[model samples]
Target: MRGVVVAAALLLAAAGAAQAGPDLGNWRVDAASDGQVTASLYATNKLITGNGALGYSPVLTLACRPDGEPRWSEWLQLNDAVSASRKITMSVMVDGTSKFDESWSVGPRGKLLVREGDDGIKRLVSANRLLLSWRFGLLSGRGEADFDLAGLSEAVGQIAASCNTDPP
Candidate 1:
């Protein structure tokens, strides 16, 4: 019984130590096959009231390219299927300030690619929270999601350094 108790205490200590090391809550960074570094974060709050709902939280991704026409790109992956090759109005608030409320093009896979040279990227990098709301036509209804930008700056800095691009 004494040996078993000691082993359990050691295991608990190990688990605590593992949780303490450089934890990026709700954020992921991955490297693509073509030398692109991408950092993504899942929304803390999800909207799932529409038809065929999957209850999936939206994803916000920022990609930095080593060699490409556009050095960087930002994308918002929605939960429902969106009409591709069309523009949709998306409203974004960063740190309680309305940054942008304009039309953005919807790309393949229901991902909305933010327009190039938008100041929203700069605002997002320095924001602590972000709220996004959009409507995918009448059939799809409306959807909104909020993200906790806890470690976003660090993730973006890592991607920027890896791709040799400026941090937004």
Candidate 2:
């Protein structure tokens, strides 16, 4: 019994240490093998429905690859699966200002892939907040998420450095 208690204490400590890894504001950076790093931040506000139903907070993820084309891939992971994998126009607002309605692709597992370009990334790094509104037809319904972009620059810098690529 004493040995078991000691082991349990050690496990708890280890778990705590793991959770204490590097974080910049609401963003969490994770390093994977082969010079890959990912930074993720959850939306500060939940998606509320017209009928007063609340949905889970969406996650914005930035993944850096050392030897992949484009080097970086940005994803908005929705709580529910998208109806289909197709092009959709998403309304974007940065810092409460209307940005643009960009065409985004719904990748596998309902992940919306941000268009590959410097414009989108530039806005993200320089803004304090991001709001995305999309209509996923009747099946998936409409979705809106507001993300807090604090410390996003630092998180991107860390991942860029790890992958030896320029921050996008």
Candidate 3:
């Protein structure tokens, strides 16, 4: 069941990127019959520019299930191409308003992404909109990704319901 949900999330993300322009156009939610939900945020070069080869595209995947808390993961196509310093700073803007500003160390292989945990996930799911910006020093540039929270509220509610709990 978990594998199916994960595959669905990946499929939704890939299809969305092909359909959605480079902007915040690739937000989607997948709810599985087994009470699992996955939300994906995919950004293309059109939305995240200036990273040279390192920022071709990045995808954020959040998976939630009735038996456990949400889990987050990020994949960058050019992770190996990024030569930036290990430390990177990222900021989240909610509806044009600043919300989270923090820094994390990119792993040696450049695979690490800042984890916002349950509180941050709740905040994002509740926001009307949001933007994520990150500085990639190796590229001597930064990239921005946006998200539209149009259907997120209901999606989150449904995900919470799967656990027999209220939306966090």
Candidate 4:
């Protein structure tokens, strides 16, 4: 019994240390549809999962070039039960300054790339911050979210390193 307890304590300590190493709380590398590698910020824990039905945790996807320069970014709300074809507008702000504003059409599946193209994703990541807002239902419904761009630079570096791409 004593030996078992000691071994269990050691294992628990090891697990805690491992979780501390990378420290990417909700960010994960997603399989790429195109050549670029992708990392997404999503909640997988039970607390977030429990509230999944309420559409609380939207997925924020960031794609990077092979050389670690940001390629594009996307956001999509998940688990929304309403099946209405709708139009929405998304805006991005950094340091209280609006950087991107675009309209998107969401299908019945509730999946939409809220913003894309040569938007300011690279610049935002370079500056290490993001602020997002969206409006739907003919501007009747709106929401906003903020994020602190901590450790993203290192995360992007890891993506490049994993793919064996030279960092840009």
- Best model per lDDT: 2
What are the C-alpha RMSDs, in order, of all predicted structures?
Answer: 3.6, 5.0, 10.7, 5.9
lDDT computed for candidate 1: 0.77
Q: TM-score for model 2?
A: 0.76
Model 2 lDDT tens row, 1-168 = 999999999999999998785557889889887777889999887865435566678888888888868777777887566565777788899999856798888887665656554457776897898998888666657788888888889888988888888888
Clash pairs (backbone) in predicted model 3: none
Candidate 1 per-residue lDDT over residues 1-168, each given as its tens digit:
999999999999999998875556677999999998888999887667456554778888878789866787778887566654677788888888845786777877665646544255677777799888887667666678789998877888888888887787
**What do the candidate models score in CA lDDT, each in turn?**
0.77, 0.79, 0.58, 0.56
Note the clash tally of each candidate: 0, 0, 0, 0
Candidate closer to the true structure by TM-score (higher is better), 2 or 3: 2
Segments of candidate 1 deviating more than 4 angstroms: 1-23, 49-53, 109-114
Ranking by lDDT: 2, 1, 3, 4
lDDT of candidate 2?
0.79
lDDT of 4 by residue, 54-144 (tens): 3365556666554334345455554442233666666777766756776755645654544454354556556545666665345335555
lDDT by residue (66-161, candidate 3, tens digit) is 665444323223343234556667787887875678664465566545453466666766677667777655545666666566666665555556
Q: Tell me the deviation in Å of residue 29 in model 2.
A: 0.6
Clashes of 2: 0
Q: Which stretches of candidate 4 lie over 4 Å from their true place?
A: 1-20, 32-37, 42-55, 64-72, 81-88, 103-110, 114-119, 164-168
Q: What pairs collide in candidate 2?
A: none
How high is each candidate's TM-score? Answer: 0.78, 0.76, 0.56, 0.58
Better of 1 and 3 by lDDT: 1
Q: Pick by TM-score: which candidate is best?
A: 1
